[model samples]
Target chain A: MHDKTIAEISAGLQGRKFSSVEVTRAFLARISQFNEELNCFITVTEGEAIADARAADERIAHGTAGPLTGIPIGHKDIFCTRSIKTSCGSKMLDNFYSPYDATVVSRLQDSGMVMLGKLNMDEFAMGSSNETSYYGPVRNPWDLTAVPGGSSGGSAAAVAARLVPVSTGTDTGGSIRQPASFCGITGIKPTYGRVSRYGMIAFASSLDQGGPLSRTAEDAAMLLQAMAGFDPRDSTSVDHPVPDYRASLDDGVEGLTIGVPSEFFDQDLDSEIAALLETTIAEYQRQGANVKEVSLPNVGFSVPVYYVVAPAECSSNLSRFDGVRFGHRCEDPDDLLDLYTRSRGEGFGAEVKRRILMGTYALSAGYYDAYYLRAQKVRRLISQDFHNAFEQVDVLVAPTAPSVAFGIGEKTSDPVEMYLSDIFTIAVNLAGIPALSMPVGFVDGKPVGMQLIGNFFSEGRLLNVAHRYQGVTDWHLRCPNGFE
Target chain B: MDLSIEDVKKISALARIEIEQQDIDGYVRDLGGILGLVDQLNSAETDEVTPMAHPMDQVQRLRVDQVTEQDQRELFQSQAPQVEAGLYLVPKVIE
Candidate 1:
């Protein structure tokens, strides 16, 4: 029951093979059995989940169920859930319960999906490894010693472990795809503005996008279908028609041109991963897709550009967490400055503080142009590189990360080394394009992800490409030892 | 662009994050490392490129000016650390 995909579970619910309550209980049982080892969940709303499952059972009985009705899913803790603790994996928001649900959460609930609980993540969605999480690092289910790639580590870990059929994740840089890569699950970050960001905790507002992490592209499509659409509440939400993502999963990729960027295959990439990527491309060629070598000249600047832009935006966005309103506050403050400083210092983790400081420095009067403005201008060149590549191909394919998951605490000491984890995935965010990471193969018994990037508003096509690849490969089907 | 310990302190204060004095040196080293990395952007010739503040080309959507939310001050302030008289209580200014 736990191993079924969203589509399979939806069918089971429709055919009355099992009640939503039974399915939800199965997942809750799994959570109890394995959650301590992985730390994948921050909060398990067992009572609320059972109640929601009972309601879903009623909907299923009434024959008024939607495709996702009665399906169980988890939310990354970053999304606000009214009346539920929505900690963004920080001590600051440890006691914070939102007064309203994020648009993504409400949309999924309206689809009749049962909520399992909130998953853990990096503090304020700041780190590449779950090590920065206040709840403790989420262990990679495949190998408990290895760190699950993060920001959305808990989301990808839970989905990979089959604790849930699908879960929601937000990607500011490579939060969704990198973790999905490390955990051997499928995750997609839709085109920026494709999904509303209102009520979702802000982190680098320009790059953050909420999407789905699941076992397969087909399941991701079903989840994305419900989560994608416009909301007037989000000023940046694109007012575009939502496409039937599930309906387009079977669209063949024959004659589609897949761009292979030469820059992505540079000396910095691990040779073993690069060789695996070639074999993956060969499989695409066999499926009637043509591959061409393309160039993203400014691609080398992506990591640097991202560091400046993301931290600058985060610095401003996170300023709301002063002692006054919601979130943690220090005791016995001597003055307003003391209250602000101590409250924030005690609330935020090391990584979050580092980013806030970097942002503050970049945006300071004397350094603004040399750092912030320069990064933004170079950002356009990076976007133009994608534009040029897309003109020659239907989509771009690259490794999701340089390598598989590393041991916990290995890269945490060096912030730049940790930042390099998103090298292959950040440029997509810079261009506001849609990208998906699907398991392609493994290295040294650990999983590797191949990323597929498409032009703006091309999520359906990206899903189609991933769906066709998933149909031909069984990598996504492999489960970890203990979990299986 | 290497940051000094004083620079780290200034930035931390500007960001309103209190850094312990003992940790200032570590922050200076780490923050300096990050700045050094991002400094590579200085080499890129972006004179002809326009700054992209957002990923998409769309402008912010405008809506009619009307009150869409009902007064929920009590409910909203329920999560505050200190609330009195239906207002959030903070350190007094100009006392």
Candidate 2:
């Protein structure tokens, strides 16, 4: 039962082979055994899980259940779960519990899925490696010593280890795909306005879009069907109709024009991972998909552009934590200025503070044109590059990260090196298009991912290609040692 | 361009995040590297390109004004560190 896909489990649940509570208990039992070892979850809602599962069983018996009615899923700690600590993986919000549910949370609950609690993430969803988490780094289930690629690290790690079949994640510059790459799972970042950001604590508002990380593309489709939709509460959310993602999963990818970006296959790419991508492309070709080499000439500027843009937005977005309405407070204050400064200083971790300062410097009067405005222009060029490529092809393929997961402490010393780790995934965020990362093969006993990028609101097509590719490949099915 | 400790201090004050005396130098080094990386933006000829503030070319969605939400000030204030009567407590500002 633990090895089954979410689709299979849903069928079993509706067929009444077993109750939702029984499945929820089985996952809860797995959490007790593996959570301490992997540090995947921040909070495990044991009493709530059983209670929700019991309610789900009643709904299932009443025949008023949806496909995900009894399904068990966890949300990244960034989303607001009422009465649960919506920490956003930061010490500032460590004491905060949102009074309302994030749009994603309420929507999932409305779908009748049982909540297993919140998963860990990078502090305020800031870092590429999970090491910056206030809860402590989440170990990759594939290999304990390696860092799970982050902000969404724990969400990926938990699903990979089968603690849950699916979990929610956010991607602001590769938070979802990079960790999903490291943990060897399927994850997607819907278009900029696809998911609502109302109660999902803001990191970089323009770039932060929430999606799901699951064991297979099919499960991602099922989850996204529930998670995607316009919310009037989130002003930026697009007023587009939500399409049924599950209905399109089995659509074959024949005659699909796949664009392999020339810039992505650069000198900096790891050789073994490049070779694995070659094999993955061959499988796509075998399925009658055509591949062409396209160029994103301005792609080189993505890292620098993102660093400027994300931090500038972060500095502004994070200003709500001034120690007044919610979040952390200082011990004692000589004045109001002291209260604001000391509270924020003690609340935020080092990387967050660095970005905040960098942003303040960029958005400061003298440097605005040199940094923020200039980055926004270059960001337009990067988006233009994608706009051109997608004109000739239906989707673009690239490596999700430069390489497989790095050792936990390998690149923490140099901030630039850590920023470069997201070189491939950042451009998509800047472009505000949908992208998916699916496991292709293993390199150095760790998994590598092939990223499929689509034009805006093309999540269904991206999932179609991944589901088709996954049908012919076994990489998504293989479990790590000791976990099996 | 490298950021000096004084620059970092001023920026930290502007951002309203207090930096530890010992941590200032590290912020100087890290923020320096970040600035150095973003300096590449200067090389791009963005004079012809328009700055993109949002990913999609959309305006903020505005709706007709109405009373929509129930007052949940008490439930919302439950997590605050210092709430008294119905307001968040902070140190006195005026003499």
Candidate 3:
């Protein structure tokens, strides 16, 4: 039961092979057994899960079930779940419970998907690794000592461990894809305005977009089908038609034009990872796809531009937690300033504070033009690079991260080193293009992922490319030693 | 642009996050390092380029200015740290 994909589980439930209660209990039991070691979950709603499972079983009996009915799924802690602790891996919101559900949460719930619980993440979705999480870092199930790549590390870890068939994750930079690559799972970040952001805690609002992490591209497609589409509540939500993502999974790769960015294969990338990417592209070529070397010249400046833009937006977005309305508050205060400062100081973790300060400095009165506005101008150049490349190719392919998972304490001390982990993934977010990371191979017994990027509203094609490659490969099927 | 300890202090205050006096030096080093990396952007020739505020060039969607939410003040207040009657409580602003 634990080995089944979401599509398989949905079929089994409809065929009456097992009740949703039984499947939900199986996952809850697995979570209890392994959670202490991985720390993937921040809150496991056993009671609510059982109740929702029972309701799903009843719906199945009535023959009114959807494709995702009774499918157990996890939500990243960033999404607001009514009356549930939606801690964004921050002490500030550890005691906070939202009065409503995020649009993503309610949409999945309306499909009758059983919610397992909220997964852990980096504090306010700020870090490239789970080490910055207030709940503690999530260990990669592949190797217990290695760090699970983050912000959505818990979601990727849980899915990789088969605690859930699918889970929701948000990627501001590389949060979803990097962790998915580290944990050997499938994760995708749709176009920026493809999904609604209402009730989803803001972090670099311009770059943040929510998507799915699952065991296969097919599973991700099913999950994404339900999560995409416009919501009037979100001012930035794109008013576009959401296509049937699963409908294109079997679309062959014949004559598919793939762009291999020359900048993505620069000296900074590890040799072994580069070789593996070459082999993966070769496989795509064998399937009748034409590969061409393309240039994204301004993409080299992505990391610097991202640091400036993301922190600036984050500084403004995080100002809402000033300890006056909600979130953590100091025990006593001599004055309002003390209440504001002490509460925030005591509440946020180190990395979160660092980003807030960086953002504040960049957006400050004197430095705004040099830092924030200048970065935005460079951001346009980066997007233009992608636009130029897409003119010749249908999609772009690259390595998801520079390398496989690193040790827990490896890059935590040097913040710039930690920021470099997101080098390849950040430019996609900056351009608001759709990108997916799927397991390609392994290095030193750890998993590696290859990223596929497409133009805006091209999620279906990206899924098709990944799904077809998955059909010819078995890397996505390889479970961790202990996990199996 | 190197950050000084004084710059760190001012930035922390502006961001409304308190930094311990002992930690100011660490902030100076770390923030300076990050800014050093970001300074590479100065080399890019961005003349004649428009500063992109967002990925998509869409304007803010407007809805008719009417009440769209029900009264959930009590439910919202339930999560506040301190509340009296129907308002949030904070450190007194006026004497």
Candidate 4:
């Protein structure tokens, strides 16, 4: 029962095979047994989970339950849950629980999904690996020594370990997709404005977007059905009507066009990853997908542009943590400046500090035009490159990461090496397009993921490609060793 | 783009993060490598292209100005390090 897909779980609830309490308890037991070893969860809300599960059972018994009535899902610590600790994996907000639920959490609650607990993440969603988390780094369920890709690393690790059937994750600059790839799970980062960001603590607001991480693409589709919608509180949210994501699972690539960027296969990429990507592309071609070579000439400079833009926004957004309102404050200070300086100094981790400095430099009085303005211009060029490619193809294909998950702490002391891991993913955020990472096959003993990117509002198309591939292969369903 | 230990210290002070002297050299090297790669944007031409700030070009949608939520100050302030009667307490500033 614990290993069944979301669709199968929903069917079981409809058929009265098992009660919601029974299923929720199974997940709770699994979490207790594995969470200490994996360190994927920040807090477990067993009390709330049981109460919600009982309510769901009552609803289903009365024939009033909806699609996700009995399914269990976990929220990334970044999303504000009323009366629950929404730490964002930072010591600053370690005890800060919001008085109201985030719009995404509210929507999921409205849909009757059971809440499991808060998952761990990089502090303020800043790092490429989960090593920067204040609580501690999340261990990959596949290989404990390997990283679980990051910021959303905890969400991916939990789902891959089958602790929870599905979980929510936010991607600012590859947080969702990269971890999903490293942990061998299916996750999507929807286009900007597709999901509201009102109460999901800001980390580069223009780039942050929340989506789902699950064992299969079909489960992601169902989760997205509830998570995607416009809210008045989030001014940037799109008012576009939600589409039925499951409607096109059978829509295989009969005449579909997939763009393979020439620049993505450059010399800087690892040879093993490049070879694995070729096999995945060849699989699509065998499925009748029309694969064509596309060019994104300006893509080579995406890392520089992202570093400038993301840091600049981060410095501004993170300013609210000055110990004036609701987070960590200094023990004692002689002056307000001392309070501000000491609080922030003690609150943030090394990576967060590095970004704040870079951002401050980029947006400084003398360097604004040279750094921020120029980076914005380069961002436009990168977006235009994707637009031109999309004109010739429906979606683009590439390796999710340059290589499989590296060992924990391997690149922590070197920030540049860590930043390069996000090379393939940063451009998608810059272009504000929907992208997903699905497990393709294994490289050595670890899993590798193939990335599929689509034009804005093409989440349905991206899921269709992933779901079709997952139906024919066993990669998405493979569980990590020692997880049972 | 080559950052020195002094530069790292200055940047850390500017960012308001405390670090020991031993860690400064490593930060300088790491930041320099990243800045070195980031400087490539200088050669990439983005002339004649309008910078994109947001993905959609939708006009601003305004809502009527009104309070939609109640002030739960007590519930919210409970998480603060120091709080008073409906206000957050902090160290003295001006002597």
Task: Order candidates by lDDT, high to low.
Answer: 3, 1, 2, 4
Ranking by DockQ: 1, 3, 2, 4
TM-score of 3: 0.99
Docking quality class, candidate 1: high
Q: Interface root mean square deviation of every model, in Å?
A: 0.8, 0.9, 0.7, 1.8
Better of 1 and 2 by DockQ: 1
Cα lDDT for residue A192, candidate 1 = 94
Encode model 1's per-residue lDDT on A169-255: one tens digit a residue.
Answer: 999999999999999999999999999999999999999999999999999999999999989999999989998988888988889
> Model 3 - which docking category?
high
Off by over 4 Å in 1: none
| Model 3 Cα lDDT, one tens digit per residue, A67-111 | 998999999999999999999999999899999999999999999
Which pairs, if any, clash in model 1?
none
Q: List the residue pairs that clash in candidate 3.
A: none
User: A398, model 2: CA deviation in Å?
Assistant: 0.5
Query: What ranges in model 3 sit over 4 Å off?
Result: none
Q: Ten-residue segment with the worst summed lDDT in candidate 4 chain A?
A: A332-341
- Clash count of each predicted structure: 0, 0, 0, 0
Instruction: Give the CAPRI class of candidate 2.
Output: high
- The model with the greater DockQ, 3 or 4, is 3
What does the lDDT read for residue A291 in candidate 2? Answer: 93
